[model samples]
Target: MATPVLSAERLAASYTYHAYRQLIDDLQAEGKTTGPQQSELLTNYTRLNVQRMHRLDKTVQLLPELREALAALRKPYVWLIITEGWCGDAAQIVPVLEAVAQASAGNITTHFLLRDDNLDLMDQYLTAGGRSIPKLVVLDAATLTEVANWGPRPATAQQMFLDLKSQDLPFEEFSTQLHGWYAKDKTQSTQRELLALLKSL
Candidate 1:
């Protein structure tokens, strides 16, 4: 058979909705007020780093292999993203998951769970078992059983992209770093390594 053409994802359109803009505003508020010079540094960081998650084409270019890794998965994956609106990680990964959802007949469902509003839900993840904000709970939607997870820090791919972009490394190198982190077995080590590795991406 001929290679299949990828169709456009509708939810993907709504995925980046006003929610992301609100995140940008929140992110600004969360930052400590700095002198004009120091503020300029962060401005550059965000300007250089503000990840517009809605643009599918640009995101893929930022990390082609990572996108493929997500594309390879079969979904119906319930992605409960426990996050604060101000978090940079949420800004990055939510869009990637949205794109993945767009690709696979909506196999992925991206739910943004605000940390302050959903204490019970978050406490479950933030506990020893629970983890932190931007924790991606990838589960079997039907059974409500978890399958796999990635996040809190490396939770959002846009953050990773910014890290990679800052280093000015090519996409292949970024993919190499990410997969290496995923390959680790211990949870604590896995989380730490992934965060460190993404920072290097």
Candidate 2:
């Protein structure tokens, strides 16, 4: 028998975008920034992502290509994202995803699930055999069938990470370099890749 598929409906019922944002806020209120399982570096990074998300949520501009693609979407879909408060990549990407879902104008809705809390689901969407996070699993709301998926980071960023990883850079150095790339890119690469993914669906 095939492995049981987790339903988008269940995940969405567990956590919506608003709930995820609130989770961050609650963490910040408790003088914590990262998830229970993460390190101090992730704490600081998570704080930055919170600020970034707020700024991007207000000012992130969707490229014309993404806008047009979203406009052409007739079928409704669910963007079920697996993430956690400590995930720096999720902090950067989730806001942009929310922007995309908003631009879809009722054609799409976004949801969130903490990676640790949803390991069974995350295992199915792992990045290169590791439980790397911020995976976006797009599904048909009516059937809970996957439409498309994208995650962790844009291709360019992922490659940069891989290159640095090959050198076995220290965690601090690796994070600094990775975040530096994210700062410079300003999420353009992410938007471009997600647009392509959506268009293909």
Q: Would you list the C-alpha lDDT of every candidate in the order shown? A: 0.48, 0.83
Tell me the lDDT of model 2 at 69: 96
Best candidate according to TM-score: 2
For model 2, the superposed segments whose C-alpha errors exceed 4 Å read: 1-4, 33-41
Show the colliding residue pairs in model 1. Answer: 76-107, 93-156, 125-130, 125-131, 126-130, 151-155, 164-201
- The lDDT of model 2 is 0.83
Give the least accurate 10-residue stretch of model 2, judged by summed lDDT.
1-10
RMSD of 1: 12.9
Considering summed lDDT, which 10 consecutive residues are worst modelled in model 1? Answer: 2-11
Candidate 2 global TM-score: 0.91
